[model samples]
Structure formats: structure tokens, C-alpha cells
Target: MKKETFSRVFPFALFMLFIGLEEFARFLQGKDILQVGTHAIYWIYPVKAVAVGAVLIFFRKHYREMRLGDLGRPTQTVASLLVGLGVFWLWVNMDWSFGTQGAPSGFNPNVFDDTSRTGMTAVRLAGAVLVVPVMEELFWRSFLLRYIIDGKFSRVPIGTFSWASFLATVVLFGLEHNYFLAGMMAGAAFNLLLYYTRSISQCILAHAVANLALGIYVLQTGQWRFW
Candidate 1:
């Protein structure tokens, strides 16, 4: 991998590891990672979440080479945001049988719990809203998408298209999520935004909008499974 690819990917790799850490923490304590942990969430999440914070700080300005400027032209920005909303609506409706089975019904903050005890739900909402989009955008669109076209990814233009590479990236992106179908569609939408606007930041904004809506919906309806 190129230096830029490595840099862009490192933080995201840490994030993936952090997910495992969450599971490990829960497993070690005999608690369910998916459920609202009355006490387990307090120490396990905050402590491990610090590692993610550190990784974020380390890569704060690392993707400078990508030039993800101005979040695309005005038209692209509006379109991407609209597409994001559309993705959110579609995401909730489609649950592929091959994808994840819904989580066992569990405690959701709005209904069975609140932010008072652990504040984990609130923290997760913040992450979904703020950090996740930025991290995934740079890794998947700016780096991986272009990286697939060429190892010297920076040489590949932001919007460069290759059918095989694009589809592969979409599949990989889809596999990353619990809902394969929706995730693939979401990936395609974000990838299209990158292709159209030629702006990594636009993809970032689009992803943020989608996740923000998902977070809001999850919080409002006590959809702990989605969280």
C-alpha cells in the first residue's frame, strides 16, 4: 500500500479493532454488547472509545493530500445530501434475508433507558453524527475507491471509474454493514457522489446526513437493533 493509503486506512483499521474490543469487553464481563449495559457500558465503552479518539487526533489532518475541499460544488452538495436522505429512507425499509438478522429486542434509550446512567447512547449518537462519516468517507471513497484503480492512489483522480473496482468496492462496503443490501445501495450512492462531484468531502457530508438520520430514527423509535 502507498503511504497515503496506509495513513488513510490506519485510523479506520483502529476503528474496526475497536468494534472487536467492544465485543471482547462484553464477552469478558458476560454482558451483551448489543444490549443497553446498565453498568458494563460505563467503563468498557468510554475507555476504549478513548483509543478511537486518539486515532482520530492522529489522523486529524492526514488526508491533506486528497484535497477533499469545499464539499463539492453547490449542486453536487445539494444532490448528495438529497441522495443521503433517500438512502436513509430506503435503508430502513429493506432488510435482506442474507444480511443480518435483527438483534434481539433490547433496551433503547428513549424507551427503556436514558442518557443519565452511562450516557453511552448519547455518546454513540454523537459518534454516528460526527466522527463516523468523516472516518469512513476518507477511507472508503478517497482512498480505497481510488486505491482500487491504482496502487499509487493519489495518481488516480477522485472520480475515476472502473466497473470491476467499483463493484468490488461496493461489495466490500456492503459487507461492512449489518444490512448487506442497504449497505451496498448506500455504498453505491456515496460512490456515485464521489464520482459525480469528484469530492471526497461531499461523500463525507452525504454519509453524515444518512447516519444522522439513522441515529435520530434509532433514538426516537427505540430501535436498539439498528444502533
Candidate 2:
């Protein structure tokens, strides 16, 4: 692919690759390939965060669509924040039977004792609220959404809408989450926000807010499944 495409896709791809590796490690444990005492699978989160976070930082300058100035308007900024809070509310409540099943062990940092748990949880939370929003917006919104509108994605205007791109992004984004319905709701909300403000930074702000709220909720309620 082109350099622009690589810059946008690589971090997201690397993040997913680590996720795949985590699952593979779980599978191997289930099959007795790795003894329970020897398995350091939980470390995968920090490692994944650092690796993908580094890539995102390296390509930060390439993300022209993520201009922080784009979010300068008060009305749009408030709207994005409200939409994010609304999506977070919907997300926690939408854990219905139809949603994908939660992982059998949902990122429990408590597996390690106090200090380690706190450290791991902090890393995970940072990854979710910080790195993830930027990475996902770059991939799901800045790249794929526009790419679906045209192969020459850089040529397409930011937030340019089409039924095919909108619907495809909505469905695929939903599938990316365990809470499929909530994911779809969040995807639609973000997509609409993009259309309204034509700003990737706005979507990132919304996403970060949603994740921050979810992280607080999980910590408060010990709802590891939501993390």
C-alpha cells in the first residue's frame, strides 16, 4: 500500500495483532501448551500498548485530519462530549444476550498483587482512553471510512458521507466490540458527529470521553466485563 495508507493502518493492525496473540496464548493454555504458573499473558496488554502507542507517536505528524484546532468551536465541542457520555451510558446498559459474549477472563489486573495490579490497570486505562481513541479514529474514520468512499482515500474529503461507507463502517465497527449493539450505537454517533463537524479530532475526543467514563465505571463497580 501507499505511505499514507501504511501510516494510518499499521498501528491499528499492530494492535489487533497483539490481540490475536493474546487469544492464541489463551488457546495454548487451554490445551496445556503453557503451564498456568509460567504464563505471562497479562503482560501482553502493556506490551501491546507500548508497541502500538509507539507506532502512533511515530506517525503522529502524518495524521493531518487530527488537527486539534478543528475542535475549537464550543458548540461542537460540547456536543461531542455529550454524545460521548451518552454513548458510554448506552454501552454499559446494552450488555444484552445478543451482544458477543464477554471474554471468559476480561483483563483482570488483579491477577497480580497490589502494585502490579495498579500499574497494569493504569497502563490499560491509558491505552484505552488515550492511545486507542487516536489509533481507532485514524483507522476507522480517517482511513477506512474514506477509503470505502474512494480508493484514493486522501483525495476524499474528511467526513464525506455515502450510504455504503456509512453502513459498512457501522457494521464493522460494531463487530469490533463485544457489545455489538452498543458498538453500533457508538459508531453511528461518531459517524454522525464526523458528518456534522467534519473533524477527526472531535470524534477522537468523543471516543476518549466514552472510554474514560467506561474505565471509571469498571473501576468503581468491578465490572471487568465492560473493560
Candidate 3:
């Protein structure tokens, strides 16, 4: 169990560092070390994406044990997709204008850089839709969700539920995003999905579905704040 725990944990801890890495880039931009516009984002997303890739590679064996191939039943996939979309709907409406501090600004490809606007937007969207969901699911749902419930989390079974683990994951997951309230709502939904399906693959698929919708919505509406 210790070996298995290590197998699941090490990569996830490293993966979470992407948030800090981006914040560091933002700090550099703040200090005038890096340009505010595209220059900062250009380095941020790609580096994080690369880091996610590296973690996957480093833990390839254990990652495989994660049973990514065992995505979920067809019914589970369909239901999760709908849930994902529902979360997106709730997310867009749950802004801070009511009272809360607004979510931190998300990636904005248009005003941020100029060299290759179209290409940069493509990369940004791709990373958000493709890369972010996979990495986050692996760390959050596949590992942290159970790990928080037990030391030998792997034996705990997927969809294992304890109020402590569920709420802890929900709050922490919510805090990860800029939109505190909406993120909290989304976290709740995703956590429920894991509970319902007991499949990391389904959780990943659901998250990917949400991100894809969000990417498209952000692009079409020019709501860069959601990026």
C-alpha cells in the first residue's frame, strides 16, 4: 500500500505545482520581469502542459493502473456528459457580482499577445480543453479524493464516500479556480460524478466535456474571463 500510495501521490503533488508555476510567471510579470500580454501566458500554459506530460511519463506504470482504459459504462458516459454541461451552465451564471470577489482573470489570448494571435488562441484553448481536464482528474479524482479518505487510498475503492473527504475535496477543488463560488459549485458536481460512477475515466470525460463547452463559449462570446 505504501508503494501504491507513493505511485499515486508523487506525480499528483508535482502536477499541482502547475498552479504555482503560473502564479510565479504572473509574479514575474508584475515585477516587470516578463511582459503582461501574451509573453506571460505563452510560457505559462505550455510549461504547465509539459510538466503534466512529464508527470504522466514518470508515473506511467501507476497511471496505467489507474484504469484509464476502463472509462465507464455507456450510460455513465452519457450521464456525466450531461452533468458536465449542466455544471458549465451553473458556472457561467455564478459570478461574484452579487457580493463575492470576482474570479481572478482567466487566460485571454486576444489582448495578451500579438505575434501569432490565431495560433496562440488555438494553443490556449487546446490546453484548457485537452490538457487541463486530464491532469486535474488524475490528481484530484483519481488520487487526492481517495487519498484524503485513507492512507492506503487505492484500496478504498472508487466512489468511496466520507463527508470529510467529499467536503475537503470540494472546498479545495473550488479554491483552485479563480471564481470561488462557481468553482465550488463545479467541484461539487464533479465530486458527485465520481461518487456516481466510481470511474476516474468518467470523471475525466465529464471534466473534458465541461472544459470543451467552456472553451467554445469563451471563444464565441469573447468572455476571456472564463478562460
Candidate 4:
């Protein structure tokens, strides 16, 4: 892969690697081949977050689309916030039968005592809100969307649209989540946001807003499945 591709793909790949490891460990635990408790798997989230977060920071300079100046006007900021909140509302409601793959064994901090649970919940929420959005937007919108447009993805301007790229990205993004329909809806929304603003920072902000709202909702409703 080119340096550009490596810069964009590595952190997200690392994040997914950790997730795969967690799943494999869970499989072993299920079969009684691994003696570790489920809480041990929970640690993978923060570990991945930190590992990927560090990589993102290291390659921060390479992400031209994420520059501080590209945050857009006040109007665009408001639009991002509104769209984000709207997506969050739709996401929780759209957990219909066909959309769900299975009952998600989501992050449950309740397994720990009060202090550890509190810390674990905080870390999970922080990873969801802050780290995930940036990592995902970089992979999905900034890289794959353009990469599909052209192998030399950096030559393609950010938010350049083609039906093939758009449809493929939306489907792949949906498959990345348990709630496939909701994920597609969000992916489309964010794709359109990129089309409108041509700003990855706004997309990140929108994603962060949606995640923050979902995190709060999960905490309040005790809906660990959403986490």
C-alpha cells in the first residue's frame, strides 16, 4: 500500500484487529478453552482505543481534511448538530427485527463493582464519543469513499461523489454495525454531510454528537444493548 493508504487505514485496522481478538477470546471462553472472565475481554476496548488513538495522533498531520480551519461556518455547525441529533433519534427507534443481526452483548459495566464500573463506563463512553468518530470518518469517508473513486485516493477531492462509491460505502458501513439499517441511515446521512460541507471535521463533529447522545441515552435507560 502507498504511504497515503497506510496513514488512513492503519488505525482503523488496528481497532478492528482488537475487536477480532476480543471476539476470538469470547469464542474460546464460550467453549471453556479460555479460563478468563468476560471482564478481561472488556479491557480490549480501552486497549484498542488507546492504541488506535495514539496512531491517529501520530498521523494527525497527514489528515488534511481534518485541519482545524475546515470546521465550517456557524450555520454548517448548527446543521451538523441537528443532523447528528436527528440520526441519534432515528437510530434508537430503528432497531427493528430485520435490522438487528442478533441481540447485542453490549458493553456492560455492571459486572464490576461501583468504582471500577464507573471508570469502565467513563472510558467506554469516551472511546465511543471521541475516538471512534474520528477513526471511522477517516477510514470510511476520507479514505474508502475516495479510494473507491480512485486508487490514488489523495488525488480525489474530499466528498467527490459517485453512485458506486456512495452505495458501496453505505452498505459496508452498515455491515460494520449490529443495527444494519440504522448504520446505513447514519452512513448516508454522514455521506450527504460530506457532500454538503465537504468537511471531514464536520462529519466527525456530527458523529461525535450522535455517539454522545446515544451514550447518555444508554446510561439513563440502562439499555446496555445500545452500547
Candidate 5:
């Protein structure tokens, strides 16, 4: 194969490998295989971030580099604002969906109990703000959506929207979360960011900001039901 073809395929293959390894490890360990919550934020989350960063570095020539400044587009700003409102509206609409479980009976409130000595809360916060945004944006926005349009990802326009790719990814993303509605909204918003700014970094930043705000709100309001 040509060097360009190899470059295009390698990062995506590595991403799939990383995801499979993480999931298989989790299955074998019967819990979070990385033990992310047990380790300090500086140690665990940063290591995961480094792994993602390394992949980007290795594929720097093939992959597009996105930066925060790229998000200055008016459409991107509007989309980001709409994302926030959409999430809040989804929360309100799904209030009954959460039910009245409460505490340890049906749901464990300790997950959001930041006062606890366990590092789970911190780990979750770090993952949301740092790790998740990078990996997810790379996969969902930069790779899968473009890959759906054509094999040559670099040549594919960033804002290209395919109904098939959007729905498929949104469903997959939703299944990853306990709050299905919230996850669906998140997936849509991230895709919209890519569509508006034509920058994966903008989607990454928007995702991180949304998750960080949601995390803080969950802690403050004792809305562990969302978790």
C-alpha cells in the first residue's frame, strides 16, 4: 500500500485497538480495568490523555490539526449555545424517566458524593473534562463521520453530514451512557459543532465544557440520577 494509505489507516486501527483493549480489560477485571478511580488524576487521566496525544502525534501528517482559535466561527458559537439549552431541555423532559429510586435502593447516590474519600468522583471529573473529549471527538467527529462519506478521510469535507453516520454514532454514544436522552443530545451537539466550525477541536472543547458543567451540576444538586 502507499504511505498515504498506510497513514490514513493506521491511526484508525490504533484507535480501535485501544478501545478493544480497554473493554476487554474491563471484562476480565470485572470492573474498570484501568482502575482509573484508584489512581491520582495527574497519574491516571493524564496517562490516558498522553496515549491519545501520542496517536495524534504519530498521525500528525495525515490528520488535520484543530485548535481553539478555529472555533471563532459565528455558527460554531451559536451551535455551542444551543447545545447547552438542548441539554437543559432534555433534562427537564426526562425528569420522569429518572423515576423516584433515590439513594441505595435503586440508585447509588455515592457516585456523585464528592465528599467521599474515594477518587471516583475526581476520576470521573477528569475523564469528562480531559480524556473523553479527545478520544470521542477524534473517533466520532474526525474519523467515523468522514470515513462514512469516503475512504479518504483527509479529502472528505469536515462539515459533510451523512444521516446514516449521524444516527449510527448517536445510538452507539447513547448506549454508553445511563441517561440515554442526555447522551443522544450530546452526540447530536458534538456533530453539530463539527458541522458548524468544520473543526474537531471545537467539538472537543464544546463536549468538554458541557460535560464539566454537567458534572459540577450533578454534584451540587445531588442529581446522581443522571449519572
Candidate 6:
């Protein structure tokens, strides 16, 4: 393998491993270590985003050499808008399946009562709207999905569709959300954005839009169950 390939793939691997370890630690502790007090959950959002962002940036040269922009090809402004709408529609229409089945059951709503919850919520919402999109799109769309098709990932034509890659990424993505089908759908939608515009940015934007919408809806409606 080329040095560039190794460099690019290494940090990507490390980021995934770091996330896995962090999440496992949180699970083992049976609490959000990043949560401040009882009702605040955003304290760790920046840490998480910065950690991953640093990894991606450290490998920035290699990532750029990999032709990341190609993945965002055939860009269409309308496609982005449509994706946003489609995601919203899915969330609205699939309430029975995604709402109940995908919703968290164990957390107390009072967790957000603490004054710290405001800062945490704002921080987390910012990460969702800003940091998460770039981090995830680079990993899922620009890297793993394409890497699954070929070790020389950049050579794996943009907009290329492969069932194996699609399903594998979706499964991994779903697993990250505790195997929820709603998470699976979210993963699938991100992939679809890649399919439509061949742009990783579009996927990121769509995801950010979806999450932002959900976050606002949850806050406005006091539906902490969805959080």
C-alpha cells in the first residue's frame, strides 16, 4: 500500500477506535461521564468533536490527496433541500416505529432541569449542527464506505454504489446507536445523499439538518424521551 493510503487509513482507524473506547467507557460507567451534574449533557460535546477533528486534521494532507471533493460531485442545491424535507417527513410519518422503538426509555426527564443543562444542550446542539457533520461525513461517506470497495479508496469512483459497502456501513452506523432501526434509517439516508449528489457535504448537511430539527422539536415539545 502507498504511504498516503496508510497515513489516511491510520488516523481514521484510530478515530474509530477512540470513539469505540469512549463509548464503551460511558456504558461501563452506566452514566455519561461528559454530563455535567444531573441535567447537563453538553460538557463533553466539544471534547468529542475536537478529539475527532484533530485526528482528521492531522491526516488532512492525505485526506485531501484522496480527492474527498469528488465524493461531493454532481452537487445540486435542490437535492439538499429535498433530503432535508425527506428526512423530516420520515421522522413525522414513522413516529410509531421510530418514535417509540427508537426513543430512549431509561433516562429521567429531570436530567435537564439543572442549569448546566442549558450550556450542555447548546454545546451539543452546536456540535450536531456544525462539528458532527464534517466528522461523520468524512468517516462514513468519504472513507469507510469507499474503502470497503477498494483499499485505494480514492480510486473507487464517486457515487459508486455497492450493496456490500452500503449494508456494512449501515450496520456499523446502527450499532453505534445501540442497534436501533431509526439509526439504521439515518445511516441509509446519509448513504442516499451520497448517491444523489455524490457529495459528502450534502450528506453532512442533511444529517445536521435532521438532527437540528429533532433537537429543536425535542426541546420545544419537552419530549426529552427523544433526546
Query: How many clashing pairs per prediction, in order?
Result: 0, 0, 2, 0, 0, 4
Off by over 4 Å in 3: 1-3, 10-12, 31-38, 64-72, 98-103, 112-115
Q: In candidate 4, what are the lDDT values of residues 11-64, reduced to their tens digit?
A: 888988898898899889989999998888898888888888899999888887
lDDT of each: 0.74, 0.89, 0.74, 0.91, 0.62, 0.65
Question: Candidate 5 overall Cα lDDT vs. reference?
Answer: 0.62
**Candidate number with greatest TM-score:** 4
lDDT of 6 by residue, 1-227 (tens): 67555655555565567556554555645555444343233234447756666766676666553344543544564676567667755664454553343335322344655775666677657766776666666777777888999987888865689999999998777666532565677788889878877776667667778778877877777765555
TM-score of each: 0.83, 0.96, 0.85, 0.97, 0.64, 0.71
Runs with alpha carbons beyond 4 Å of true place in candidate 4: none
After superposition on all C-alphas, the RMSD of every candidate to the true structure, in Å, is 3.5, 1.4, 2.8, 1.0, 6.0, 4.7
Assess candidate 4 and give its TM-score to the true structure: 0.97
Candidate 6, position 71, lDDT:
39
Q: Model 6: which residue pairs collide?
A: 39-111, 42-120, 71-198, 72-199
lDDT of 5 at 224: 58
lDDT string, candidate 1, 80-125, tens digits:
7898899999988876566764442333554324445347776666
- Residue 115 CA error for candidate 6 (Å)? 5.4
Compute the lDDT for candidate 2.
Answer: 0.89
Per-residue lDDT of 169 in model 1: 83
Error of 1 at 126 (Å): 1.3
lDDT of 2 by residue, 66-163 (tens): 88897889999999999899999999998887776555366766678898889989998999998999999999999999999999999999999999
TM-score ranking of the models: 4, 2, 3, 1, 6, 5
Which 10 consecutive residues of model 3 have the lowest summed lDDT? 96-105
